[model samples]
Target: MKLEMIGDIHLGMALNRKKADFDFNVKKRYPVISVSNIEEEGYFNNKGFEYFPSTELLSKKYFTEEGEVLMRLTHPNTAVYISKKQEDLLVPSYFVKIKITDKNYLPEYVAWYLNSEETKRELQKVQSGTRVTSTSKKVLETLVIKELSIEKQKRIVDLVELHQKEKTLYEKLIKEKEKQLAAATAEIMAD
Candidate 1:
């Protein structure tokens, strides 16, 4: 077990979008992930997106890639893992792309940890601005990340995926029950 500041583990140190010349009026073929895509748990499961034009470089910049972690600047600082399938999608300026260079850490696990309650509280303390309440690149780089062996990180990620699946199932069950109850209530009036 080890603890390291986020700055020491990455090749790219909190690559945030700033002063980009992208034209918002132009629509691109792909959708860029927005803050709305993040759920209460900070999982990027929702398909929220905004159409934005993709520019060459956008300042010689990189797009989202597999094994990369993205953190939303807004409150809760939602962090998401970039799977192979999610690669090629444009990450908007509001997101700070964190690519972990350390082989000891897995991006999925790192993202999961960032979204954890402990990290959330830590980030809340460093938040800036009165209205938007966003996090800065400096704070992100200074954040502490608890390190575990690669095997343990993998196991933890697997367990989280299973838990997410369970939550989905429970939500479906509740919706089905609600439908059945509504139908039954309608029958009472017909009797």
Candidate 2:
């Protein structure tokens, strides 16, 4: 199942042809979301996002609105969904911003699908460069994904969110257990 098979992908395809302009050395007020901003569990972590030097770049041209999907252009492995109900966030050049035009499929579904192992494998096949493997715009345009009902997509997204929450709680639990173990060991050794 391919994206084109569902509907007119070109209609939904919204690639800001304008090149991302920002001076990395110059820090500014606006926060820019890079690939690193995405956490290990495929969630946004704004603790250390970079600042775009140009406020002019923040205009709809370079920023991501709600439900917009941002994928890593270099590796094409991570797809971070902009689901926050707030002002647009700037997306840097390292990532490709995708706007799903198809009403049948939700943007969240597309983001989740892009981050799936199957999609990664397919992207890897067309990626170039031995040192830093990367997929191109053409590759993204022709990418195939399993076509499913909107309801199923919603359920999948919900399950993934639940799994992420579980993973986060599990990590915290492990950390607390480790601290307890360390303190107990120290007390016993001192005795």
Candidate 3:
């Protein structure tokens, strides 16, 4: 099924405002989320975001809701599905925000598909530009997505999450082992 059939896809805030307009003194500054904040693991990295000036124009259209999927338009393009509400973060112009309109497809599942190798390969083939490669809105709309049952999507997402958690734990363990080895080497040299 085509992605447009499942949801609406549009660019994020295109306003070009200066830093002087933002209220950076307080913790409630309007945070602008960029493509750099999304990690390869399909989660928000919570880093490298800039704040925008709060204005009357900051409507519901600027913020992303739960179940919304975000895709980067620039090179190294990636997609992430928001499972929970992220307060103070507004989607920026370089990212595309997709809000699901149909119940047949899960937001997380669609995000997973977008991040998959299959989709990435497809995108790499047709993506335009030289310095800053990006997929056109029209081209992106034509992507064919596999239709899967909600139950299976949930199961797959769960399994992927589990695998990621395990991978993180293993990385931590390896770092600890390396530290221990270094300490042991130092102790032997001192003796």
Highest TM-score scorer: 3
Estimate, for each residue in 33-150, the C-alpha lDDT of model 1 and write its tens digit: 7667767664666575765444324432346777778888788678888888777666675677887777878888888988999989988998999988988777777787888888
lDDT of 2: 0.69
Instruction: State which candidate has the highest lDDT.
Output: 3
Model 1 scores a TM of 0.80
**Model 2 error, position 165 (Å):** 0.5
TM-score of each: 0.80, 0.81, 0.85
lDDT at residue 69 of model 2 (Cα atoms): 73
Please report how far candidate 1 places residue 125 from its true position, in Å.
Answer: 1.7
Residue-level error in angstroms, candidate 3, position 133: 0.8
User: Which 10 consecutive residues of model 2 have the lowest summed lDDT?
Assistant: 7-16
Which residue pairs in candidate 1 have backbone atoms (N, alpha carbon, C) closer than 3 angstroms, thus clashing? 57-60
lDDT of 2 by residue, 29-129 (tens): 56667566786456775467665455233355566777777778677568767786423666666676776667888877887888888888888888999
Candidate order (lDDT): 3, 1, 2
Candidate 3 achieves a global lDDT of 0.78
Q: Which runs of model 3 end up more than 4 angstroms from their true locations? A: 18-28, 46-49, 53-57, 85-88
* lDDT of each residue in 21-83, candidate 3, tens digit only: 545533345778865678876777647677676544466777878878888877666888876
The per-model lDDT (C-alpha) reads 0.71, 0.69, 0.78
List the candidates ranked by TM-score, beginning with the highest.
3, 2, 1
